[model samples]
Target: MKPILTATVVAALVAIALPAVAQNASQIARVRGGASCAGCNLFQASLSGLEARGLNLSGARLRQADLSLTVMNRTRFSNADLRDVEAYGGVFSSSNFSGANLTNASFVGAYLQGARFSGATLTGVNFSGASLQRATGLTQSRLNQACGDEATQLPVGLSIPRC
Candidate 1:
């Protein structure tokens, strides 16, 4: 009976500690040069289903990160390194993405209306089912390069490019 009670206690403690241990996001934003991002390194972090509206993440490194279903309205990602990140179903309206590296990033089912992408490298990015109406620095040629799906919403008459 004593051994069983101890085992149960140990198991409970381990179960409680497991979630905290698993939620450690890699902090790697220790670079110089940026107004909003002075210090932060968030590589491959799991930010899925988080409500981070109006957050300042400028110049943050989030490569290969997961930001699915995250509400990022008015969020600032200017000059941030977001290569190969998964950000499907996020809200990025009125967000700033100037000079950001969004290579191979996917924004499926996201609301990116009024989002800015000026001077950003969007090579191999996917915007399938995402709304890009009124998004800055987003052109038809850019869309062609990124290759979105048929459900992607553009300004007008802008269909997804063929892969």
Candidate 2:
């Protein structure tokens, strides 16, 4: 009985020490089922290779999520929290990111043609090899807050610092 009590206490301590999963499983299921899950909590979600087009994820919390190779063309991510997301090789053409927080996010080799970035926070974002040639609502000030490699393609007369 004493040993069992000690084990229970140890398990409780371990659970407290670990970070809690803030994602909503039901919302994730909805997304998986090809449903739009606006304002959902998707923290640290692994959504690689997902091919959902026109997804409406506005106001969602997608911090530290993995979107590698995901084809979410024309998706809506307005006002979303996307900090530290990894979106390598993803196709997000014409997507909406207005008012989104993209701090420290990586978009290496991603396609973002004609996307909207109005009022989006681009601090420390890595756009290495990403294509944003026809993106809208981008200013020099916004680009200055982010970084890209020489292979990154932007609209004519606009450039970002090498990452």
How high is the CA lDDT of each candidate model?
A: 0.77, 0.93
lDDT per residue for candidate 1 within 60-99, as digits (tens), equals: 7777888899877888899988899999998889999899
In angstroms, give how far residue 106 of model 1 lies from its true place.
Answer: 0.9
Candidate 1 backbone collisions, by pair:
27-41, 28-41, 29-40, 29-41
lDDT of 2 at 57: 97
Model 2: lDDT equals 0.93
Model 1 TM-score relative to the real fold: 0.74
lDDT per residue as tens, model 2, 74-106: 999999999999999999999999999999999
Q: Cα miss at 54, model 1 (Å)?
A: 1.2
Q: For model 1, what is the alpha-carbon lDDT of residue 18? A: 77
TM-score of each: 0.74, 0.87
Error of 2 at 119 (Å): 0.4
